[model samples]
Target: MTSFARKVANLLGVAEDRLERLAGGDLSEVLLLRRPDGRCTVAKGGAGIGTEAAMLRSLAGAGAPVPMVEGEHDGVLLLEHVENDELFSPLAWADIGAALRRLHERRGETYGWPVDHRLGTVELDNRQRSDWPGFWAEQRLVATASILDRPWRERVEAVARRMAELVPPDPPPAFLHGDLWSGNILVAGGKLAALIDPACYYGHGEVDLAMLTLFGSPPPEFWEAYGPLEPGWEERRPIYQLFPALVHLRLFGAGYAAMVERLLDQSSRNLSTTE
Candidate 1:
């Protein structure tokens, strides 16, 4: 098939030549065409968009508020093209929080995402780890610190090492979207229609909260729902945000470099205060 949607359709058992594409997004294109049942539905296709599709499939009908995937073709994912007004609104953010709260309430005996996916222009790897401190040290904090250069690199490593020791013990291992940014929240009818593009994994539930506030203030209700499920994590937001800031630092350049410095400094301050 010429279009990504068609490719996805063929992968999902639809005829490739008969496939048609409808719209496109940052990571994938959306398609509208006949399902084997002959009903029109949306499909997704592109580099690594399948990861996001797989994520949604795991959460589908779990009632946490996400789209449903019909099938796949090539690298394309056939999904319900949900019509939504906007993924970001006061009410939608609150619902997102509530939805996440319910999601985290489902526990696994581990810490890490089942898979990793990109965050906007950034790539986040969610390899499994036995402990949060080591996970943050090796994967999130230390791993990113290794990529830095000069004084800031040393500075981040020092802060990461210190924070790694001080970060609270493993509270509860729960599924996190791993990247719950404003862009991933979808709203319909002034309500949250779904949580799209999750880098699904099991880890500190608060990791999702940290990411929500990393770029900007997610709706208060979003945190409110998650907070009751796991409280006092707002205190550790900076530590979690450091991972993305580091990713951005590597991807965007000095602008993100400055953010890394600030996050490290903030992490040091938070750790000292709690100590």
Candidate 2:
């Protein structure tokens, strides 16, 4: 083990004889540590790990299924090893829907989290605001504009300007898993074991639902468990989805540019219909 890993193990009061690397996203390094007695723990090390630990604790407090935070020190976060299955059963889909519903029920008085967070190379400007439209416009949309080309930046700015007309002026500020895709979810024993790797904040609940649909659609069982959404959720979905599309464009490169343009066009149509 590296000196940092050894220090983390000592801080968490664990003695691990073996370390195995696990799949991780762009921002973090994940590893599984096993003791001679068969006990196991997962350690994630990178920037913002402590913040991830706090987010997990917050979600767990709100009755959402998440890995228990064992300890956090320096830049390392220790977590309980959660078993996950690659295949998601219908029961798991429904369970995730229900879990997400419960998570969104935990409301906040304002939009955004107390501290800013990062997604890939972009810093999420989570400065709390009372106005949802303003939050979405300035913090979510316009914040990404700096890294985009002039044309794309102009398009984003135009949408940001119309945020008040596009989104609700003041929806209930529901807690959100700011990054909610299939990959972040874990299933075991035909149920949702945990929602991991969160970039959490308080925002429109539809933001999460939109992100859930970004890569693919959830099953009908999911919607049935989640219940009906607000009437205009479909139209607002593109607006919410645009942020992640932009993030992907920035992170993965130009292949996602078409996805961004498509979502932008959809968002424009939504504006036209509203007008």
Can you give the TM-score per candidate against the true fold? 0.78, 0.93
Tens digit of per-residue lDDT, candidate 2, span 173-266? 9999999999899999989998899999999999999999999998999999998899989989999999999998888899998899999999
lDDT of each residue in 104-151, candidate 1, tens digit only:
877778777766666555556677767878777666666665656777
Global local distance difference test of model 1: 0.70
lDDT, candidate 1, at 1: 49
For residue 83, what is the lDDT in candidate 1?
69
For candidate 1, report its TM-score: 0.78
Mind sharing the TM-score for model 2? Answer: 0.93
